[model samples]
Target: MSLLENILYFQGGLGVLANMFLIIFYTCIILDHRYKPMDLIFCQLTFIHIMMFLTAGEIWLADIFESLNVKNDFKCKATFYIYRVMRGLSICITCLLSVFQAVTISPSTALLAKYKHKLKQHIIKASLYIWSFNLSFSSNLIFYVGGFTNVSETNQMKVFKSCSLFPINYIIRGFLLTVTTSRDVFLVGVMLTTSTYMVIVLFRHQRQCKHLHSISQLRTSPEKRATQTILMLVVFFVAIYWVDFIISCMSFLLWMYNPVILTVQKFVMNIYPTITPLVQISSDNRIINVLKILWSKRHQIFKKRWFFCLL
Candidate 1:
C-alpha cells in the first residue's frame, strides 16, 4: 500500500478500536445503578458522540475503496446526511449537557435555581427541541449532496473533496452552524464559569466544615462529586472542540490540504468523540461502582443459566 493508504488504514483501525472502547464503556455505564436519573443524560450525550464517531469512521474506512472506485448517489447523499446530522446533534447535546450541569450547580441567588424543577421536568422536551432544530435546519443538505459521478454525469455536482459531492451547502449549513456555535459559546461559557465557582465554593465549604465543630454547622453529608466530573466533561468538550473548530475554520484561511494534513485532521475528527464516555466512566466513582455491580449481576446470571443448561 502507498503512504496515504497506510495513513488511512492506521487511522481507520485506531478509530474502530476507540469506538469499541466506547461501546464497552457505555454498556458499563448503563449497568451501573448508583447514578441517578440525570446521569442518563450523560449516557445520551455519549450516544450522540458515538454516532459522530461512527459517521466519521465510515468516511475514513470507505475512502480507501472510493479512491479506486467510487460511490453511488444514494450512498453519497445518505452518508453525507447522516454524518452531518450526527455531528450537529453531538455538538448540540454537549451544549445541553453543559447547560444542565450549570443549572444543577447554580447558586441560590441565581434565577434558574428557583426553577430547578423545570430542568428536571423538561429534559425530554429540551432534547426533542434540539433534534427538531437540527433536522429542520439541515433539510437543505438533502437536495445538495450526491455522488461525484452523478454530479459529473448531470453536470451539476459541486466537489467537496472526500466521501461525496456536496454543493457549498454553505448558506444553510452556515445558518445552522451560527445558531449552534452561538449556543455552544454561551452554554460552555456558563458551564465553565459557574462550575468553577461551584468548585471553589465546595472547597471553601469543605474548609468551613473542617474548621468548625458544631453539628448544626456541618455541611451536607459528603459532597456531590458529579459537579466536578461534569465540569471536567465541559472543559474537555470546550477545549477539544474549540481546537477542532479553529483547525477546521483555518482550512478556509489557509486553503491548503495535503493528504498528510487531511489525514491527521480526519484522525482528530474521528477520535475525539469516542473519548468522552471513557472520561466519564473513569472520573465518576458512582458510575464506576454502578457498572461493576451491573457487570457482577450479569456474570452471575450468565453462570446460573449455564449451570441450568448443563444440568
Candidate 2:
C-alpha cells in the first residue's frame, strides 16, 4: 500500500513478534523453574500489548472483521472495546510493574520493604482487580462507539475507518471524561512517584557501592539492572502516553478527529509496545544467556552437517 500503511504494518508485525517471543521466553523460564520476580509481570504486560496491537493495529482487526462479513456496528464496538480494555490493562500493569520494582529494590528498613514478602501473593490478586476495573471502566465505549457511515445527517465523529463515536449527552460525556482522566492521572502519578523513589534508591546504592569497591570492581546486581530497565520504560512510557492522552482528550472533548492527528496518535501509541521487548531482550542477562546457548547449539549443528557433507 502506501508508506504509512507499510510503517503501520511493520510496527504491528514487529510488536506482535517481539511480545510473543517474550511470552515464550517467560514460559520457558517458568517451566524450567528459573523465573525471576518480574517475569510474571513482564509476561502479563506483553500479553496485553499483543492484544492491543492485534485489536488496534491499523488493518488487523478490521481486516479480519471484513473477511468475516461482520456488521460494522458490531465490529466497531468490539474492536474499540477490546482495544480500550487492553490499553487500560497495559497502563495498570505497567504501573504495577514500576511499583513492584521499587519495592523490590527498596532498602530493608524502608516502608516498601514490608510488602516484599507478600509480593508473590499480591501480584495475582492485583492483576485480577485491575482487569475487572478496566473491563468495567471501558463499558462506555460499547454505547458511544459505532460504525461510521457517510451520512452527514448523523452526528458521528469518525476515529477509525469504520468506527465513529456517537454523540452523547454533554453531562454524561463530562462525567466519563472526568472519571477516565482521574484514573489515568492516578496511575501515572503512581508510576512517577515510584520511579522517583527508584532513582533515589539507585543513587544511594551506587554511592554505597563506590564506597565499598573501586570503580572497576563495582558490579551491577540483577535487581539493580532490572530496576534501571523498568525506569527507562517508565520514562519512555510516560512521555509517549501523555502525548497520546493529550491527543485523545482533545479529540474527545472537541468531538472532532483529524486524519493526520489520528495517524500520529496511532503511531505514538504503538511505539511503547514495539520498543519494550527490544529493551528487555537487550537488557536481560537471562534472555541473553538463553539466546547465546541457542546460538551455540545451532552453530554446532551446522558444523556437524558441514563435516558430514565434506565426508
Candidate 3:
C-alpha cells in the first residue's frame, strides 16, 4: 500500500481502539452503578462511534485493497444509510447530552431546572425517539445509494471515490438534501446553545464565589468540569463537522476527484470519538479516584510482596 493508505489504516486502528476503550469504560460505569439513563445514553453514543468507525473503516479498507470485490447494491446502500443514521444519531445524542447537563446544573428556580427531576425519567423514551427519527430520516439514503462498479485500470472503485446521492431530478434531490442538512443544522444549534448556557452557569457560579477564595485556593467544581468537557466535545464536533461539510461541498462541486478530502474527512470525524473518553476520564472525579485507589492498592501489595521476598 502507498504511504497515505498506510497512514489511514494506522489512524483507523487507533480510532477502533479508542472506541473499544470508550465501550469498556462506560460498560464498567454502568456495571458499577445502577444503569442510569445518562449512562445508557452515553453507552449508545459510544456504540454509535464504534459502528461509525467500522462503517467508514470498511470503505477505507476497500480503498486500500482494490482487490476485494464490492458488495451488492443493497449492502452498499444499507451501509451508507446506516452510517448516515449513526452520524445523525451522534449529533442528536450530543445535543441531548448537552441539554441534560445544562438542565442538571441549572439554578433551582430556572425553567430548565423544573425538568431536572423529570428528564432522567424520560431519557430512555427520548433516546428511543431520537433513534427512530434518525433511522427514518436516513432511510432515504438507501434508495439513492448504488453499488460500486466500473472499476478502472488502477483498480479504484467508484463507491470508494464517492457514493451516488439521490439519483432523482435536481429538485427532488435538493429537497432531500435540504431536509438532512437542516436537521443537522438544528441539532448543532441546540448543542452549541446548551453548551454555552452551561459555560455561563459555571461562570456565574464562579463569580459569585470569587470573593470568598483566593486565586490559588479556587478549585474546579464538578459542574464546571463537566461543562468544560461538554463544551469541548461540542466544539470539537462542530469544528470537525463543518470542516467535513466544507470539504464535501468542495468535493461535490469539484466532481469528488480528491482522495485527500475523503481521507481528511474520515480523520476529522474520528477525532471526537477517539478523544472524548479520555476527556471524560479527565473531567470525571469518580473515574480518576477509582484508578488512583486501584493503583495505590496494587503498589502496597507489591511493596509487601517485595519485603517478604527480601526476608
Q: By lDDT, who's the top model here?
A: 2
Off by over 4 Å in 1: 1-35, 59-71, 107-109, 149-162, 165-184, 213-223, 252-258, 290-311
**Candidate 1 per-residue lDDT over residues 2-118, each given as its tens digit:** 676575557555545554554565557558744444655765666666566555546553565467575566556666676777766766676667667657666677776775767
Clashes of 1: 2
State which candidate, 1 or 2, has the greater TM-score. Answer: 2
Judge candidate 2 against the unseen true structure and give its global Cα lDDT, from 0 to 1. 0.88
lDDT of 3 at 131: 92
Q: Write the per-residue lDDT of candidate 3 for residues 1-311, one digit (tens) a residue.
A: 66766877777677677667667878987888755556677788889988887777666534533456555565567668778888888889988888898888899978888887777677878898999998898887576567655434333224344454433555765676678679889988988888788878877777777866643333556566666777888888888888877766555433344456667777777777777767776776766886788787997889999999999
lDDT: which is higher, 1 or 2?
Answer: 2
Q: Considering only N, C-alpha and C atoms within 3 Å, which residue pairs clash in candidate 1?
A: 32-290, 32-291
lDDT of model 2, residue 178: 92
The residue pairs in collision within model 3 are: none
lDDT of each: 0.62, 0.88, 0.73
Better of 2 and 3 by lDDT: 2
Q: At residue 182, what lDDT does model 1 achieve?
A: 79
> What's the CA RMSD for each of the models?
6.0, 3.1, 5.3
lDDT for predicted candidate 1 compared with the true structure: 0.62
* Error of model 1, residue 153, in angstroms: 13
lDDT (tens digit, per residue) of candidate 2 on 87-112:
98989999999999998989999998
**Worst 10 contiguous positions by lDDT, candidate 2:** 214-223
